[model samples]
Target: MKFTLLLFPLLALALRSQPRSRTGVTEHVTLNLRPGISLETTNAGAQDWIFQIVGKWSGFQDGHWGLELGDAPTAVYWFFNWDSVASHQEFTRSPEYPATIEKVESLASSFSAPHVPLQPFPPREVFASPVVSWVTFNLTGVANSTATTNWQATANDFLGNLTRVSGYRAHSSGWEVEDSRVFSVLVGWESAESLGAYVISRSFAEGFRRLVSGVAWEHRVLRVAGYVPKL
Candidate 1:
């Protein structure tokens, strides 16, 4: 399950711009589990809280929740599509917010929730896949206009190639508004085995080197099984 070359980071910068009919945003939440806390316990607690929100909150479009895999696996990630940031903020002020947080807080040592606007919002089917690969890239140095443009081209090409791979279900990406230098990608696959196979392939090795060469950056990739709450 560990391949040094296969672990190369993928994609950076936002996708090509396009018009949108409505404003939308995806909230990325990471909950790092407390020591000795099991994923099953955390998942059950979180799922109950999410179910309540989805059922009552009108802004909740769709969601994908899963436990992180590989290095630093003691975390759970949730990607939720909301109507807008304002709607999410409204949810925070709701009466149910504090009780929900209290339920999940016991299992998590720390957590972070950041929102990004994904151009051409991802469909519900993407997160519905068997496995999802969430990757984040943090630009190491100053990201000037020229360097960013070049990186965009390379990143887009790499993302395009990923779609051609077998078992690739869907892909969506965006840059965090709070921190422009931070980029995120969500790619769905039929299975973790397929993703593992693709990562070790010769093509991945070449593409990875091309993407990261001379680009001072740090990245993390987490493979997680798609979680669909029974409503």
Candidate 2:
């Protein structure tokens, strides 16, 4: 009875000492941006608008998201990071996104629904890095097996070179389990500037095209340092 009484107080003290803030945390999300749209159109205007916002406003405090563009991605795949929901709320209410309440309502209609929410499949934990340079190429008219092989090969070459350029590098890709037709790649870089330099550089840009040519990948989305998986 005496030992139990002593242990209870220690356990209570430990629990009280735990940190309460959830800031600098990351969350995974799968947003169905334009699920029902036909290939001809998928709210290109809205997509572009959001892309602009993400590029400019995101990564403000070492918090960002990643995108997984399938052959027909609807802008759902993303990872969100923030010190906490409070910062996010502030950002949403900031003059950048909504100068006035009226303007906010007017532009709000553009979203598919719940613009940024937790992903369907929960991640083990948010990556330690605040940013990840990533690109998603939509595969066109290629077999699943072929797409994977092509992606892996491209990853092998690109990751090695990128790592050499910058000491930090990692690459990941996954084919849609539901339909082998879709595939996506996630590449990491220490800084967004490094990614931009490589993307536009003649030497690296053409290599990207050549790598995806066989699989006929379309460069749909290029996102800056966003999110990475912890486990």
Candidate 3:
């Protein structure tokens, strides 16, 4: 199946009845592997350390960590959902926190962890999917109400088309809490090839052009190898 770019002006109104809460926090972590370190090595080390600290952290709802595909092959993307920012901060005070950081730092040359409240947090199936796409868009300027409204309409239109694409599984998005102008979207797909095919399609071309017009954005496709806590 292929998606088609089409406007649905009533999309927002149709979704109005479905309340979307921004209570939870999603931590997005990027780990750039150190020189000479293979993805296999990092995965193995992760299993022994970071992965083991999952349930131990209070408020940890769900987690997914996987090696990135395409451009940054040696990088890993880790997504962790928590009850709230306070919950995540509480975890940082735990004894295991330092040890976990030490283990991750050993394998990574550099890393960054940014927390955001992904409105309508993605379900577990999204992370369980074979491939995931992480896309971020930085608004050209301060996002006023007008800009946000326009973006939302364009996004809804684009997403409406996206759902029709073959292999599209699930998606979620939100603006960065620390930087409201930075918006991010997470999409799950059956395979990287499926996502690539969609990206080159006319639907994508038109939708993406409208969505990102005058905005700076980047994306990464990840081959999900495993999920934290095995589910």
Candidate that scores best on TM-score: 3
Query: lDDT winner among the candidates?
Result: 3
Pairs of colliding residues, candidate 2: 23-83, 24-83, 28-119, 29-119, 31-76, 132-225, 132-226
Encode model 2's per-residue lDDT on 1-231: one tens digit a residue: 012222322422332343433434332233333346422244434544454554455433333443442354444334544444344445554566533323212223232111122221122122333335434445555567666676668756765566555424555444432233545444555555675677777768766766667554534233332433221
TM-score of 1: 0.78
Question: Which regions in candidate 3 have their CA more than 4 angstroms from the true location?
Answer: 1-22, 39-43, 70-72, 140-143
Which regions of candidate 1 are displaced past 4 Å? Answer: 1-22, 39-46, 70-73, 214-231
List ranges where model 2 is wrong by over 4 Å: 1-77, 80-127, 143-151, 214-231
lDDT of each: 0.67, 0.42, 0.72
RMSD of each: 8.3, 16.6, 10.6
Clashing pairs in 3: none
TM-score of 3: 0.83
Residue 229, model 3: Cα distance from true site in angstroms: 2.0
lDDT score of residue 81 within candidate 1: 80
lDDT of 3: 0.72
Count of backbone collisions in candidate 3: 0
Candidate 1 per-residue lDDT over residues 1-231, each given as its tens digit? 111211211101111122222468887877777777765553565656655665478777777777776644787777778777666666666787666666666667666666778865844666767677776666656458788778778889999999789989988888875567777777888888888899899998898787676655533345554554423
lDDT per residue as tens, model 3, 70-113: 65477877888877766766666677766666676667766666
